[model samples]
Target chain A: DQQVKQNSPSLSVQEGRISILNCDYTNSMFDYFLWYKKYPAEGPTFLISISSIKDKNEDGRFTVFLNKSAKHLSLHIVPSQPGDSAVYFCAASKRNYGQNFVFGPGTRLSVLP
Target chain B: DAGVTQSPTHLIKTRGQQVTLRCSPKSGHDTVSWYQQALGQGPQFIFQYYEEEERQRGNFPDRFSGHQFPNYSSELNVNALLLGDSALYLCASSLGEVNQPQHFGDGTRLSIL
Candidate 1:
C-alpha cells in the first residue's frame, strides 16, 4: 500500500510565479513531513519540513503547510526560479517507527523563464 | 564534514549475479538507511541500520540485506539479482533518532542485464 501519494506527476510554472506541490498520506500515525528536491543524477537535497504540532513551516522561498484533518500537506515556492525546477518528493515518518521513511511518487516541476 | 558517500556510481550485472554497494555516513552520524528508486518512481525503503544492528525494515524481501560497521558505515548486498532489481540505490545518514532529517548520497545506478 502506498502510504504517501502525490497525485500530480508533473507541473510547470513561470519563473516569477508561485509553484505549489501537494501530497497526501493515508497513515494517520505519520506526524513528520519533509520535502526534498532532486536534480538529474544527484541525490535528493532536503528542502523543508513540518511537524504535526505546527500547521506551517517556512524556509526562505519554501513553505510547507499541513492540515491534519485532511491528511494532506503542500509545499509552496513563491517567485519560483529556474533553479527550482526538479523532481520534488514528500516523505512521511512516524517517530515511533524508528526513522523508516515512506516517500511519495514525486512530482517533476519545471520552471519556465 | 563530508555528507553520505556511496561508491561505484554505476554498475552493470547479469541475472543471478550478486552485487554489493557501500556507503559512508556523514561525519558524526550514527544511523544509515537504504532506499531503492526505480524508473520514474519514488524511493522505497529497504532497511535501516543503527548501532550495528538492523533497526527497521520495509516490504523488501530477504534478497536485499545490509550491514553496519563500527564506524557507522554501511553496505547493501543483493543476491541472485533479477532484472527487476535494476534501479538507483540511495543511502541516507542522520544523527540519532527519527526526529532528525536525513542527508542523502548521489546514489549508485545499478543496471541488471
Candidate 2:
C-alpha cells in the first residue's frame, strides 16, 4: 500500500502565478513532511519542509502547509518562475526514524514563461 | 563541497545475475539510505545504514543488502537479479539526527534484461 499519495500527475501554471501541489498520507506516525524538486537527469533537490507541530513553513517563494488532522499537506510556490518547472515529490517520515522516508508518486509541474 | 555521488550511472544485468552499486555520502554526513524508484512511481525505501550498521530496513527482502564503510560511504548489493529489479536506485545522505532533510545523488539506473 502507498502510505503517501500525490493525486495530481501533472500541473501547469504561468510565470508569476502561484503553483500549488497537494499530497496526502495514511500513516499517522509520520511527523515530518518534506518537498523535493527534481530536474531531468538530476537528483531530487530539497525544497521545503513542515513539521506536524506547525501548520505552515515558508522558505522564500516556497511555502509548505500541513494539516495533521486531515493527514494532508500542500506546497505552494508564489510568483513561480520558469526554473521552477520540474517533478515535485512529497515525502514523509516518522520521528526518530527520519532516515526512512515514504514518498508520493510525484507531480510534474510546468511553469510557463 | 560535493554533494552525494553515486558510481556507475547505469548498469545492465541479465536475470540470475548480481550487481553492486556504490555511493559516497556528502561531506560530514554519516548516514546513508538507499531507495528504488520504478517507472511511474515514487522512490521506495530499501534500507539505511549508520555507524557501519543497518539501523532500519524497509519491506524489501534479504536479496537486498548494504554495507556502510567507516568513511560513511555505502554499497548496495542485489543478489539473483530479476527483471523486476530493474529500476532507478537512489542514494541519500544526511546527518544522523532526527528530521534532517536528506541530500540525494543523481541515481544509478539498473536494467535487467
Candidate 3:
C-alpha cells in the first residue's frame, strides 16, 4: 500500500508561469512534509519543507503548503524556469522518527520556453 | 566543504551476487540515511545510522544491511541480489537535529542483470 501518492505522473508549464504540484498521504501521523528536486541521473535534493506546526513554508520561488486535516500538501513555484525542469518528490515523516520518510511516486515537471 | 559523497557511481551484478556501496557524509553531519529509487518512482527509505549504530530501519528485507564507521561514513551491503534490487541507491546526511534537512549524494546506480 502506498502511504504517499503523487497522482500526476508529469506536468508541463511555460517559462515564467507558476507551477503547482500536488501530493497526498494516507497516514495521519505524518507531521513534517518536504519537497525535493531531482535531475536525471542524480539524487533528489532538498528544496523546501513545512512542519505541522505551520501551514506553509517558503524558500525564494518555491513554496509548500500543508493541510493536515486533508492529509494533503502542495508545492508552488512561481515563474518556473527551464532550470526548474526535473522530478519533484513529496515526502513526509513524523518528527523524531529518525528520517523514516515516505515519498510520493514523483512528478516530472517540464518547463518550456 | 564537500557534500555527501558516494562511491562507484555505477555497478552491475547478477542474481545471487553480493554488492557493497559506500558513502561519506558531509563534514560535521553525524547522521546518515540510505534510500533506494526505482525507475519512475520516488526514493524509499532503507535505514539510518548514527553514532556508529543502526538507529532505525524501514520495511526492506534482511538482504539489505549497513554499517557506519567512527568517521561517520557508511556502507550498504546487499546479499543475494535479485533483479528487483536494481535501482539507484542514494545516501543522505543530516545533523540529526529535529527538523534539519538532509543533503544527498549523486547516488550509485546498481543494475542487477
Off by over 4 Å in 2: none
Q: What does candidate 3's lDDT look like per residue over A1-113, in tens digits?
A: 99999999999999999999999999888888889999987788999999899998888999998888999999999989999999999998878676778899999999999
Highest DockQ scorer: 1
Q: Give the TM-score of candidate 1.
A: 0.99
Q: Compose the digit string of candidate 2's lDDT tens values, residues A40-102.
A: 778889998888889999999999999998999999999899999999999999997656999
Which residue pairs does candidate 3 place in steric collision?
Answer: none
Candidate 1: chain B TM-score against the reference chain B: 0.98
Model 1, range A6-89, lDDT digits (tens) per residue? 999999999999999999999999999999999999999999889999999999999999999999999999989999999999
lDDT, candidate 1, B21-43, per-residue tens: 99999999999999999999999
lDDT score for residue B108 of model 3: 97
Model 2 has a DockQ score of: 0.84
What shift in Å separates residue A106 of candidate 2 from its native position after superposition?
0.2
**Candidate 2 chain B least-lDDT 10 residues:** B35-44
User: What does TM-score give for chain A of every model?
Assistant: 0.99, 0.97, 0.97
Candidate number of the best lDDT? 1
Q: DockQ of each candidate's interface versus the true one?
A: 0.89, 0.84, 0.80
Query: What are the lDDT figures for the candidates, one per model?
Result: 0.96, 0.95, 0.93
